[model samples]
Structures are given as C-alpha cells and as structure tokens.
Target: MMNCQFVFLLLVIYMLYLFVGAAIFSVLEQPYEEQLREKVLNMWDDFLEIHPCLSEEKLEDFLRTALLVKSFGVSVLRNISGFEVKWDFVSSLFFAGTTLTTIGYGHPFPISLSGKVFCVFYCLIGIPFTLSLLSIVAQKLTIFLRDRPLHYFHHRWNTSNNKLEWIHAIVVISILCLFSFFIPAIFFNFLEENWGYADALYFCFISLSTVGLGDYVPGERSGQRLPALYKLLVVGYLLLGLVCVFLMVEIFKNLLKHNQILSLFLLGYEAGRQDEEIDHVSTNDSEVPFAPRNDETTRRRVTHSASPNEKSYGSISPSRAPAIIT
Candidate 1:
C-alpha cells in the first residue's frame, strides 16, 4: 500500500515535470516555428515573382515536385530554415533528457564544439541519474503490484504461490501493454496525420525501448502547429510510457527468478553465489584456527564444529585421546 502511494506520488511529480518541460519548449520553439513558416512563404513568393510566366497551379505543382525530390535526395535544394533554429534553454533541456534516457530521436543535436563537450559531460551525470530513477520507480511499482493487486488475486482465487506469481506477472504485463503501447499507439495514430496504426505502434515500441529511430517523432511535423495542450499530452504519454515499460521489465525479471528453465539464460547466477561464498569463507577463516591435515606422520587430528551459540575446535591426540574425550 505504501509502495502504491509512492508510485502514485512519483507519477504525479513526473507528469508535472513533463508539463513544465512542454510549457518551456512551446514558449522557446514557437517563434522559430513561425519564422520557418514565414521563410517558406517568402521563398515561394520569390519563386513566383522570378517566374512570372508560370501559372499559380503550375508553380504549386513544381514546388511540390521539388519538395518531393528534396525529400528523396534527388535535388540540390536544402531546407535551410529547418536548421536555423537555435538550441535554446527548453530545447537543450528536452534534448538532454532524451539523451540521458537513451532515446536519441535525432531530430535535434549539438552542432557546436562547446555544445558537444557539454553534452558529453551532461550525459556522464544524467544517464546514471536517469537509470537510478527508473530503477527506483520499477522497484516501487513491483512492490505495489505484489502487495496490493497480487495479494488480492492470491486470496480471492485461493491459488498456489507459483500460480499466484504467474497470475501477478500476467496482470502487470497486460496493464503495461495496454497503457504503454496499445492505447498510446491509438492516440499517436490519431494525432499524427501521416502515421498508420502499425507505424504508431512501431513508434511506441521503439521509443519505449529507447531505440528512437527518429522516423516518426511526436511533434515537429511539417506545416503542423502543435497546440500547447497537445504538446503536454505527448510529454505525459512519453513519461507514462517509460514507467510502464520499466514496470513490465521488473515484473518479467521477477517471473524469471521463479522459473528454473528461463533463469538459466540469465548470466552469472552461480558465479555470483560462488563469489559471495568465497567472501564468507575468507571472513570466517580470519577468526578461526586452521585444522590439522589427516596424515600418518601427524598422530593428532583436529575437528571443527559450530553451533548457534559458539564454535569449538578440538584436537585428538592418540596418546591423550581418552582424556581429550572426557
């Protein structure tokens, strides 16, 4: 129950964080977006003025063809306005977050030497911080599911421990898939004009996995103005999607822990146990006396025994064996 509350609180804080970032990004990027739009319009007007003999319809067709050719790398005309936007505070913040999370969408990047240097240092600190934050969230989410939801299912079904564990894993995975991928994909398909259901689903999968192929970013589509509300919603979706993905991974790890066949694929299990045993033996050997070897030359033998209260080391000598026993 406490874990559930902690997850809830963390989610609330994360949503607020997304909203703050979205607000700042929208504010900083809006001017550049408008400037890019104006520049495109001015370029079109200049082209029309230069070619007065060309009809409006013909000019439109030519411009569309040019854009298509440019998109396909069949033309020399580069989209200069696209690269004119500065990496302002909000853009830098969002990029840094994405970088730390390993979701390099590649829509924006550092072009300057100083920015690249800063990026290197920023990631050194930020990646670990992001990973630790994700780990904590995943842990709390696991505890929450186990204590509240799984506990209820266990009692209600009167199931065995193994079955209950599997049931818990299934329930958590179903919820995560529904919220993180299916539902969000539906929303992304609706919001993104060019995206189909499959494309949206792929985007969600890639983004959650931090593969971030950059082919289908949420915003920044051409000729589309992202409203502040939509931007906030997208940011919220990203945060919640990441949480669900981490939660699913945590539940899957727990399931693997209970499955002998599957657990073998996990590396270093026995090696880790052996390392722990070596440490324990070393610590014990420091406090205990060495036992004598069993050899014909040494008529005395030593045996070591340990109990809850104390440990005893006894030596048996052939000459004094009777007295030693007493």
Candidate 2:
C-alpha cells in the first residue's frame, strides 16, 4: 500500500513537471508561430495585389494594428516569465520570493492574464493555509517562550506590582508602532518630499492594513529603479506588524484578567467559594426550613445563642428575620 501511494505521488509530480515544462516551451515557441503567420499573410497580400479592392493605406493601418496587438501579447508573455528586463541574480531572487509570499509588493506585478490568473489562484489557496500554519507554529512558540519569558521577565521581577507595569508594556508597544509604521512613512515622505504628514500617515495605515488602495504608492513617487531596498523594508514591516499584533493581543488578554477582578469588586461580589445552601434558600421561600416557637419558648430561653457575626432574630414575630442556626 505504501509503495502504491509513493508511486501515485511520483506520477502526480511528474505530470506537474511536464505541464510546467510544456507551458515554458509554448511561450518560447510562440515567435515561430508569429513568423509563420506573417509569412502566410505576406503570401495572401501578394495574391490580393493582383485583384486589389482595399486601399494600400487602409491595409497598412490594419497590418499595423495587428502587429501592435501581437506585440502586446508577446510583451505579456515575457513579463510573466520575468524575461523582458535584465535583472541580476539577487533581483530575480527577490522577485520570486515576494511573488510566492503574496506580498507581490505590486512593484513587480503580473501583466499577462495567465500570470494574473495564476496569482489570483495561488494567493487564494496559498495565503490562508500558509497564514494558518504559521499561526499554529507561532502559538506553540509563544507557549515555549512564556515558559521562559525573554528579556522582560527579568525586568518584571524587580518592578513593583502596579499600573506602571502595564504602562511599560504600552510604552514598548508605542515604540514598536513608531518603528514599524512611522519610520517607513517618514522615509517615503522624504523621498516624495511633497506630501504632508497626514498623507504619509494615511498611506502607512492603508499599506499596513493591506488595503492597497493604490491612491499612494511610495516607490512610485521615486522613478522605478532597484526597488529591492524599499520592497525589503515594506515586507519586513509587514512581518513585524503581524508579530506585534499577536503580542499585543496576548498583552490585552493579560490586562483583561485585572478587568475581570475589578468588575467583581464593582458589582459587590466576593471572590471566594460561596455557601451554596444560602443560594438554595434564597431561590424559593416555600423550600425554606421553619421551626415553630410559641411565647413560652421565648420566655424560657436564658442562654445567648448568636455569635458576634450573627444577628439575633426573635421567633414568632411578623417583622422577625429567620432564627440563625449554628
């Protein structure tokens, strides 16, 4: 059974390899088809010249339009393969990495329908699964780290147990927000050297949110050249933002525990094991235990029965509370 599954997997892999290889070959061989098509058209034109009804100018225009359309298609194919431009090995690596990561960064986008379709499908299926898997791994890592809290735990041990600790967390988070968000915005704004701080902040917000509104792109402000540094910065910020968001959520959870305790106090509730018997008695008056005592019982009682914590309630009185039992 294992051998059969292995063979099946290998067969599937082989089929995928063949499909990819064929796609590449088709793209590469498209020029030959175009040449053959041109040759056929030239022959037809020769034949048409003997009995020409269409004007030369009109024919020329038609041919020009056809060539333009053909060029467009060819350009698209080349763009999808990342072949049109002369890129170094590092640049190619960056492109491939960003594409797979789904950050796409939009500096290098798919021009062809085939490329766009592949991107749509790839991101649709891949991003969620990848994110979910990463989240799971992060959660496990968090537990491991908590077992040994890094850096902050040592600081926490010496600090007083007060609101200051929570403030410390907020301060750290604020610093992170500044670096992860504000620094990039400042740099981009400097490059653009035109937009106001508000605009920069808006751009930063939109980018971090992954809304990609396209109203403002930082790299576009500067003419396109080695976008690698900017791309790396943006990708790094995105990744750090993700991790920071996770950390903040954990901090909020911890803070909420204190909120819960505060709520208990505000609501006049004691945080301890409650006497369930009191609850049962309060639920129904008919279920409350009663003992009848006449006037003779009140006169004969000489000993004090109530503890200092208990209030004495005389039996057989309309305004009387229930007699306290030891």
Candidate 3:
C-alpha cells in the first residue's frame, strides 16, 4: 500500500512536469527576461512598501534583480530537467551544454502550480548535482588551460621546491581573477557612467560566483536594451569563471598533498641525525672492541659441561661406585 502511494505521487509529479514544466520552460525564454525583471522589481517594491522593515535601498535594487533572475533561472533549469534535445546529436550536445551552465536563456521553464513546486523542488535537489557534474567537467577543462603556451613561464620560473606548486596556482588564479573580475568590471564602469568601480567589482564577483545578486548587472546602463548576444556571452563567461575557480581550488588541494616539501624537510632532518650517530660510532671504535664479557663462574660451568660429564650423574648408586673404582 505504501509502495502504491509512493508510485502514485511520483506519477503525479511526472505529469505535472510534463505540462506545467514545459509551459514555464517556454515562458522563461530570453524574450521574457525583461518582463520577468520588471514584474519581480514591481513585486519587490510592493513588498518594501507593505513592510517598511524590508529596506529597498539597503538591499540595493541590482542585487535584488540578480537574485530574482537566479531564482527564476534555476526554476527554468529544473523545469526542463531530463528533457533530451533531439535536433541531431550535435545540436543536442549544444542544448545539453547550455542547460547545465544555467544558460537556459528562454529555451525552457515551468508553468502550473505543480510544475512551479516541482521546479523549486528540482532545483533544491538538482543544483548540487549540477555543480558536482560541472566540477568534473571543469577539472577536464583545467588540464587544457594549464597546457597553454603562457603556462610555461609559470612552470619554468617556479623553483623545483614544493612552494613552486603554490606559485603555479597563483599564476593561474591571477589570470582568472583579471579576466573575470577586473576586465568585466572595467568595461562596466566605462559603459555605465556614474557607476563606481566598487559596484562593477561587486557585479563581477556576484556574477562569477553565480550568486546573481542582480544588484549590479552589466548592460543595465541607461537606455540600454539587454542584447541577446551579450546576455548569452555573459552566461558563458560566468560559467567559465566558476570553472576556473573550481580548478584553482582543486590545484591548491593537490599541491597540499604533494608531500615534496614535507618529505624533504623530514628526510633532511633524519639524515643529519644519522650522520651525527655515525661520527659518534667512529670515535668510540678506538676506545673498545664490540664484544660480550662473561664472568668466571659462567666460563667454569661451560668448561665442566665440555669435560664429558664424568659418570653421567643420573645412574644408580652401585653403578656410580663401580665407575669410581675403575
């Protein structure tokens, strides 16, 4: 009976996913990005008006938007979960690639109440799985990044010592930090007049971290239309940035376990101790020969035992007397 009930619940969820999820997936497409933003913003405003405790200024409007977008975006990914792309194997690969990166960009979303619930549930479960999966993929990508021509400078200049791993890690991280955090931020500051560099940095960090605080997004400058190509590019960049961070963390972990520095320190200390012991042994060699000493009583006992054990003491008394006389 319990099994039947479980199966029934699952069936309902599956059906809910099919119709409602498809609706949300379709509605969440790039065409609706602005609309969703506006709706969420208006809702946010109303929320603050109702509860003055919810301060709008402190929260910052941009961060609010990023959160909403991320929430909706995650919902969209969850809604479309398990839907396979069929536009040939190649196109399908592209679709799968985009979905995992959270770049749904309107290709999919959720509709009905059940679907929305499912989406929320799915994301709750799926996001971690998605992250783990992406991490594996990023590890593979890191190998390629490390082999790039410029990496040679990092690898060669760093010493043969264990600290070299950290040096290499720092180099890789510097490249990622500059491109993902600094470069985008600089561009944003130029494009959006009056926006502070801090805000730009904040935006870059939020986006790259996938926190999508929305408080400071790019292309939100005055009179700017959110360009489709730009949005797509931003999504891709964020994904790559995250991958870079993961790779850096992984490399750092590997360096810690490398054991080169620790082993060298331990072995070097041990060798020094051994050398001192050897020197002491050489000095002592002239003072005494290495041999055991026996007392006179022990030596006497050995000599007596070797003398053929006169009369083999355990015989009868009469036999013993006869031997003595002989």
After superposition of all CA atoms, the RMSD between model 2 and the true structure is 20.3
Q: In model 2, where do residues sit more than 4 Å from their true spots?
A: 1-111, 133-165, 222-225, 261-326
Instruction: Count clashing residue pairs per candidate.
Output: 0, 0, 13
Ranking by TM-score: 1, 2, 3
Which ranges in model 1 have alpha carbons more than 4 Å from their true place? 1-89, 155-157, 227-232, 267-287, 290-326
lDDT of 2 by residue, 1-326 (tens): 44445456667979999999999999999999999999988986896787588787787787788776544333323333342342444444444444544444455455579967977887788777755664665466555544244346656666543464466557756865787568767876776666777788787766555555556655433344446566565556656665555555555555555566544433222222243456665566433333234534433342223223333444344456476899
Clashing pairs in 1: none
Q: What TM-score goes with each of the models?
A: 0.61, 0.42, 0.41
TM-score of 2: 0.42
lDDT of each: 0.71, 0.57, 0.59
Better model by TM-score: candidate 1 vs candidate 3? 1
Question: 1-326, model 1: which lDDT tens digit per residue?
Answer: 44445456667979999999999999999999999999999998998899899898987887788866544323344553442232545445556666788888876777569978988998899888987888788789778776677778778888877888887778778978988899888988888899999999999999889998888776655444544445456656776788778888887877777787767545235545667789998687555444334432222222333222323323433653566454
Report how far residue 299 has shifted in candidate 3, in Å: 44
Q: Which is the winner by lDDT between candidate 2 and candidate 3?
A: 3
lDDT of 2 at 309: 36
Candidate order by lDDT, highest to lowest? 1, 3, 2
Q: CA shift at 98, candidate 2, in angstroms?
A: 7.8
Best by lDDT: 1
